[model samples]
Target: MLGFIESVFLVLTITEFILGNLVNGFIVSINGGHWFKSKKISLSDFIITSLALFRIFLLWIIFIDNLIIVFSYHTHDSGIMMQLIDIFWTFTSHFNIWLISCLSVFYCLKIASFSHPSFLWLKWRASRVVVGMLWGALLFSCVCTMSLMNEFKIYSALTRSEDSPNMTEYSRLKRQEYNLMHVLGNLWKIPSLTVSLIAYFLLLLSLGKHRQQMQQYSIGSRDQSTEAHKRAMRIIFSFLLFFLLYFLSFLILASSRFLPETKIARLIGVVITMSYLVGDSLILIFCNNKLKQTFVAMLPCECGYPQPASKGPFAS
Candidate 1:
């Protein structure tokens, strides 16, 4: 039964990874298609396309890492592949988080209405703000990855001299370096999380105000614009929920490192982490009309997926 479960887990993980890549690839392809037809793409499309690209690479690293962990448990050595995985994982994961936050801020700026001078200023400079955020994310990710890679090189060198006369000292130094690097990695994640939290809070405030204003109007008097606002609010809430679940699962996964014997907790964490890309992309596709239409058309006829009629809840 234990073996059976592990096999099932591996299969599910690989399946989700493949599905996520396909979905993200579809997103990138469609965006590319649009760019080819039209000379320009919107800022939202630019962010979404770049986000999908990062997620594709991230999912690839995750799938490879999970395969090694699950199928090659006897391999205790941390070699160059592991080092690459650590660096790429850190870079891609941070990049993905930052992009999501940028998307959230973009949405809030586009959807929310506020009379404050700051709000007006932000609304005017939303494009520049997103571009700045993207560059900042890239710079931070690069720094974190390079720092980790440097530590990893030292760790790898120490690992190679396991049988040396000073083996004990080397091991101690490696452990200390690893711990410091881990802490630094966690520190690098702080800004992304802070940005995301701020965006989420601002979106929540906007949604609340919009809801209250809508409530003042009669249902019979609500227009398409009101419906669009409600749809945007729902997408923001859905994204927030996804991020909350992801962070909770990430904490659990990180703690599992200390409880090496708790395979179940680690397994659950891996599964949740792997699902984030596919799950979030699905949310985005369903919320966006163009992506939804393209995705639905690509589905097999036997799947019985209904064509979306108009831009509403499930329609897009």
Candidate 2:
């Protein structure tokens, strides 16, 4: 007796889960193989590998959470299962977001041009800076993940204590706990979102300026480099846009959590939010020549190569 909400959730979950796993799994496997053979990888490959791994875990947690909500709500609400699910969800999700911000920063460093002294310095030491940022992101995600777990624990306790006989003391404790939870949930996200937006803006500005310069010397058709630049910008913009949408979706889902009647909003929010991982990975494959080539190479082909099309009906 699956209702509309459950049906929709299942459809989106199955489609996104399969697509996300395939794309991310491909990225991870190819990069992993390269790493093994070369004994190292480029910074971009490292970041992609790390991101794909995080995404795979995040998608799994999302699937399990959705399955529990739709099929085993009674079991999920009781005892320690909810807490464990919350922990893994918060950790994997936050880590995925942080890594994406790191990717944005890396792209800015690699692609954008700035005349400021600090920008010049960063550009000079971009590799080291990116490495340090990745480590910092990992550490920060761990701290934030633990903070989320604590906030949830405190919240459960606060709910129970709301039945206490002392009204004033309960009010004070409730206010303190509410504020702590608010800060804990938002502290990491605000900074990461800000950094992501800043990177997006700077990259856009740099590309715009570059495009203007290229236009000055253009005579006929668009050159290969200009087209490439546009393609890169488009890819970045698509990824950033999806990230922003995912952020908003998560916010809606979080706010809707308290409103028991807003089932539709929560369901839609989860579906849209999960789409980001799949969409972002698709963008990476589309934008990067190497990844696109690798994916094409992996596709099954007759005689290990694409065959020319025939005019007949049963052409293979």
Candidate 3:
């Protein structure tokens, strides 16, 4: 289940995303494409797009690490590989959450009304600095969490336990460490989710206001408005689905640990995290019409699938 073969598939996923972004990266360099034809391509758009690409790249790394861990479970019980595995495990999990948070922030910026004027100075500025700050925020949080991480002794047999002979009375701090780490890890999620909800509400109100005018406008404009609404709806629905499933799983996880009585609750927690991670790409792709087209086009043209090319909502 784990070996060079699985590693290859992991590489495939990363390569696929890298290729996808590079194709889109053209939108940034040598005349950024019509991805945002409705508005001028400014530094913000460039940064947002770049951040989106970076987030996907992070996901690829996390997936590849998971595959490596899967392989290690069956391969030789080692010293070097074990240390690498532990570091990868901590890094992937922490960075994954941070990247997702950044994505959510970028999406909010894209949909919100712009107030800043597009100046050449701003447009030509560096985007990497902003991205680095976002990542730094996540890195800080992850580092803070290390202080609270629960520790258990690992043996050459690939087994870990707090109750093992190696875990002496002096080392018993599982309950305290678990609670601290869990709380710190989930703390950022609250503000991220809150911002999303507030932004969504404002978005709904704005959409509602546009609806009345959409009826009075000319046929061409009205059709455009209608299409825009549809696109907004797709994004909103995707966000809602993600929030519902993710929050439910988070609640179960917290409850299980806090209550310490419901064994099923812990299992449900694992299921939720797994489902959310695997489905993250699907959620993003399905929410954006243009992204979906890119996906279909990357597949063999011989299949003749109906990959709808989109720029704006009304792109036909």
The reply for model 2, stretches above 4 Å from the true place, is 75-78, 162-187, 215-228, 260-263, 298-316
Question: What would the TM-scores of all predictions be?
Answer: 0.82, 0.82, 0.52
Deviation in Å, model 1, residue 289 alpha carbon:
0.7
Give candidate 2's error at residue 48 in angstroms: 0.8
Clashing pairs in 1: 286-316
- Candidate 2 contains a number of clashing pairs equal to 0
65-119, model 2: which lDDT tens digit per residue?
7787777765754457767876787787777777777777776777677799999
Of 1 and 3, the candidate ranking higher by lDDT? 1
Shift of residue 170 alpha carbon in model 1, Å: 7.6
For each candidate in the order shown, give its overall lDDT on alpha carbons.
0.74, 0.73, 0.48
Kindly list the per-residue Cα lDDT of model 3 for residues 1-316, writing each as its tens digit: 4456545544554555454445434323322455445456544344435534444454454444444444443342245554454354445444544444444444434443333564223323324433764668567556744633332232322243444677554334554554455544455456546645654664565566666666666434445544555565555556557656766765665566566544445444434544554455455554555555555667676465565444552121
User: Which segments of candidate 3 are over 4 A away from where they belong?
Assistant: 1-98, 104-108, 114-184, 216-222, 250-267, 297-310, 313-316
Could you tell me the lDDT of residue 251 within candidate 2?
A: 70
How much is 149 displaced in model 1, in angstroms?
4.0
Ranking by lDDT: 1, 2, 3
